[model samples]
Target chain A: MDAYFFPIIVTGAFAGIGIGLLGVFIVGMRMPFIGSCISHTAMVGAVYATLFNINPTLGALVLSMLGSAGVAFIPNNRKNLDANTGQAILLAFMMGLVFLAVGLEQDSRSEMLSLLWGNVLFAGWGTALTTGSLTVALMVFSLLFNKELKAILFSRSLAEATSMYTHLVYFLFLCFCGLILAVNLKAVGGLLIFSLLVCPAAAAYQICHGHKAVVLTSMLFGLLSTVIGFLMSYYLNLPTGACTVLVSTLIFAFTSFSRFVLNMND
Target chain B: MKNCVALSDILIKRGSHTILQIDQLTIHAGEFVGLLGPNGAGKTTFLKLCCGLIKPNRGNVRFQNQCISRIAPGRIAHFRKHIGYIPQQAEYHAHLPFTLREVVAMGRNALKPLFHALDKTDYEIVDSWIDKMGLADRGRQTFRSLSGGQQQKALIARAMVAEPQFLLLDEPGANLDPNWKKQLRETLDRLFNDCRITALLISHELDLIPSACQRLILLDQGRIVQDGPKAQVINSDFARQLFGRTITTPEKP
Candidate 1:
């Protein structure tokens, strides 16, 4: 258990911080469904890579980027499908590809299931290192684009008017989000990653007054969820990803309750 | 002979409808111009084109003697830093995650390089604008927590903190109550009279224009019907035809 602790801790920390940061953007954009879309897309990518005998995470990264680009390429006009419908179409198409890949791999079904549910407890040192590096890279990217991001988060038109290549910045953000989801897919599972991405940040948003506070609180909530959930799963012999998401859901519940109480008091 | 902005052979089409078409127009330096039009008359679209938020389907837009459409894509950001744009205020989410002061600071931040942090001068400028907008006490409050009037004042401060030479406003005074509107009017008056900023303001309210504008341009069905002194343009029969109502004579400033 001691020997395995390092990988587990690093995995939890990186996933918490990365997903928490991305959750801020995702929630702000009002695109909660996109996180689920990205995660599932990564799952499809991972299965394909396994079939080709390559590094599954790398495959997931490339395919998830394609998934994000797919969303971006959708025409946003009255003559085309709306953004939500476009995303839904991409998600459905990706799921079909995922099923086809699974059906072809007769002997690798269990291996794919492990990827789907995420066996974070057994992820190697390589996975941990990848997660940590991606997390650091994402943090630096956020810092570098801080001002442009604020303008964008406020309004895309305002950001463009200010002379920022808002479309480029927006595409880069979606790509980064896809990358984060891809790295975590092995440890957090496709079905459960949405909870990790949204619940902690949503909980933090209910209480924090400033962007810095909200981001910090979101990271803290994500970290708490991951650590506590890992311990509970280890001790009780439960599913790690499910335990992690349930912990996050519980935190969201607690935050909502506290917010209600505070509002009533006011 | 010097023009701050020039639009030539401009045409914009959305779907199948031609939203705007202009052969030639020039806005000189140190001018406060009011843009008026009926609903769907492409006033906002024209502003977007001037600000370089949208590219004209045909022809060219020149700003500060540089052809905006011809400038390298990478240089657009540098060009935009000298222009301030104030968008219409809507109900900003109550949990928007930025304070009024931080929002104002964004203006300065936009002008600075990515690797640079806000320094003393930036903070001073941000604080001065916050104070000027009467948002000093509310600076520390989340923008979403501020009242609608306070938020608009904060947004105006954010736009002005950069101290841009050119300003574009889109019905900024729409949501403000009478008192706040009066304060905004005074602020615009100072910006135009004292700061000598080149400004183009778009509004449906005829009364707000006369006090703040020296020149006026009226659009009808996507074409400029009148462009001249505010008094002449507003009182013209063409203006009446576009507005579908009589234009009241404005008192001289």
Candidate 2:
């Protein structure tokens, strides 16, 4: 049991790094709402999976990929809030279905809540392996595509002009996001997933400018927050998810202020 | 090599705005053309049409008798590989983290990725261009750290390092003080004379245009008001009405 729990803790922290990595892309794209949409859709998929007795993680992957595609193809017109609106509708629908599932289950309300917050203490060995492998794989692929991704971030049309298929890159990035979102499910929970995506990178951007620094600093901040949050949760016997979010928030705010001071000095 | 761009009766409209309405524009290779107009004149729009960055609602832009719209996107990049575009008031943020050298190296990105490690040859070329732009000492400086004129020089260097067959300059002299304007113009004139790069430059400040551009196209209200050889067009009655100045040839008397 201890063996299983220890690796799960390591995996949770590892997946936190993936979230941090994803956060860099989000920040680079200047689209924070993307994470929220992905998380909401992932949760809906989680619900579908639970109802059908399938891997909820796979369910999350399907919905998030769909969500990313939906956003990507949406007409550039402002009215197509389809991405965010889709998230809202999906979030409510999934919550209703999960509540219904909760009612039909023999498990107690607390047990269902445990799944919602993702009790890292009970994360199984299989969960550890799945999340760890996916995170590592995603990170490696992103590194390989860094230049193309950088070109995309700078100017999509220019990237396209240079024979880099900007759309294909975006599609691949979404696929990566979906898979990584699935992996992060155990640590962040589907509901609170976006916090891990936004906080660390946003804070890092407050201090850094270029993609290189942003990627490195954000990942560091993310790993720090995840490790610190888990330690706090372990020592204080408090809720883990809340602790993680709080720590990230504090770090982001602190970094923002420090950057402001540094800018003033310069 | 005689490279030429021909646009016949190119017409374009955006919503209620007629962005570009021209009869015929033939820019031959080894010629620098000045596109002059007031604000809101479709100068940049016309350049965009030629570069295929934006398509005209009517008519088409052609290079060497090949339609720009018909070119595949990948081929369009290859087509654009020979085109240099320096947008107006290019704001360089030092925050982008590219030094003067790296930014100029982006010119060769057609051959490699933006982040791929540059080779010694690439750096050598970058060094040559940096010196050309008088930015040799400032090669290591961040983009935003440079002064306004220096930044403009760097931006031009970045665009020109590719040694494009065609160069487009949009308000290349915009916002620069008179001294800087002259400096910029001298640099541009020197580049055009040396490389014989076919170029279309847009500027509202007609006086800033160098005499080396033998042809001029005047645009206002999104339509070509005047198009002809520089001497003929500048001395015409329309030029007087447009700018409220009597321009005459020295040989006229």
Candidate 3:
């Protein structure tokens, strides 16, 4: 592989692993919309950052954190505003801001466009390093706090009742999720990143029996999707983000189908 | 006996409508109290207030003489760990992947310090509770796969694994069959008679309350209408009016 190909491949791997692991928790929590909300919020940050001549990644990270914090702190009263409804409102608001920023920009919109439709092939050493560091931090945090995370995922009320520092853990988890999405936005693109966050973990859920099994399987599926997607993009000259999402979707489809076939036989 | 939980001048309102109101209520340590009320009488809300899940709009909920609301937000979890709380129904996503064993193991999470894993002894305690609840064979099964009664039993086991000083159960006997109900009653009796765990159990079905429960508190229209010994409360004209004449006065257990 060429020198440029190495960084591209490495970036894809890190993005795949990070997004995949985060997906299980997001989907398990029944908040799949949160991924979309945070990603779009990051896009708005990146867009505005470009307009103001600031580092788009830093802006994305800060805004995504703020967005996730809003979600985490908002009261989830069903009578007033539920979490999903809150996320939907945030998503709409972010979309509006992104468009406004884009319209205001006087410079070339290539960087902004690249963020919307990611190009992993153009990933440099900086992208690979950032993605790798984030992936490692996420993995470590997940491993170290496995029991607490599981408790929160199982039932936040029960976790709180049991005195498990649930609010702190949940806030930290959301922040990490925001950070990962923001960093990966340039390589994977905001529009299609949610697919990587949902499909691989969801595919693992179709076949895995236990929590640990589901997590490991999801990680493997994520790795497979990104690597295979990268190879396909190289050979077929397709969009990297679209290719990765398609691969992850196919994996999910295959697992769901296999599960159905097995159940039919039984 | 000292007060285990005390609610003074407590008032909980939702948009100007009072859900629960009390001037004074105290549950003594080692007391097995059964809370009886009609639907929307706010028994669940009462339990939530005691455990600091919900703050009262007006007054204080004190546990062991310290005000729960006054406790630092960071230390509230520590206080809650000493009290095991079982909601009427734990709302979790259908796709949550934890097995029954893992769910039960969560009881220990609050007791241990942060970053500390469950040790072998902790697992042993969890396993023992699982066996006690007759879920030994189903430990590895996904929690969602269990029947309603089985799931309730598993949650009970989860609460008991921590060996809490106080237990707050809300309609724990719901969805249980006669056999499982008897088992639950026996478990409560043992916890009261042997373990001396202070408990406040909420149940609509009078028979589901353990025979060991000595005190009964009746609620109606957001107020405490009756508080006395179980037999006295059951035989009161007000309780009879509320429960109807179908409930007959019984010999003391």
> Top TM-score: which candidate number?
3
1 or 2, greater by TM-score: 1
Per residue, candidate 3 scores C-alpha lDDT tens digits across B101-208 of: 988998888888878899999999999999988889999988877877788778878888888988999998887887778777877776677778899999777878
Q: Which residue pairs collide in model 1, if any? A: none
Worst-scoring 10-residue span by lDDT in model 2 chain A: A74-83
The positional error of residue B164 in candidate 3, measured at the CA in angstroms, is: 0.3
lDDT score, candidate 1: 0.80
Ten contiguous residues minimizing lDDT sum, candidate 3 chain A: A74-83
Native contacts kept (model 2): 0.11
- Candidate 3 Cα deviation (angstroms), residue A210: 2.1
Better of 1 and 3 by lDDT: 3
Kindly list the per-residue Cα lDDT of model 2 for residues B1-253, writing each as its tens digit.
4557888777787778677788777889898899887778878778777787776767768876678866666566657767777765522233444456766776665565434655788778878988999989988765546777887787678677667778888787777887787788788878888887888988877666876788888888888888889988888777777777776432210
The list of candidate 3 runs beyond 4 A from truth reads A76-78, A264-266, B177-183, B240-245, B248-253
C-alpha DockQ for predicted model 2 = 0.21
TM-score versus the correct structure, for each prediction: 0.91, 0.80, 0.93
Where in model 2 is the C-alpha error above 4 Å?
A: A47-54, A74-122, A161-164, A189-192, A206-211, A260-266, B15-17, B88-95, B113-117, B172-180, B205-212, B231-253
Question: Candidate 1, which segments miss by more than 4 Å at Cα?
Answer: A69-84, A165-172, A264-266, B90-95, B207-210, B246-253
Residues A1-266 of candidate 1: C-alpha lDDT, one tens digit per residue: 67777788778878888898888877765667677788888888999998888888888999899888766555433235556666777678777888788889987887777777777866668877888898889889888887777667776657667845566767888899889999898777777888899999898888888788887898888888888887777789887789889999999999999989878211
Instruction: Classify candidate 2 by CAPRI docking class.
Output: incorrect
The top-ranked prediction according to DockQ is 3
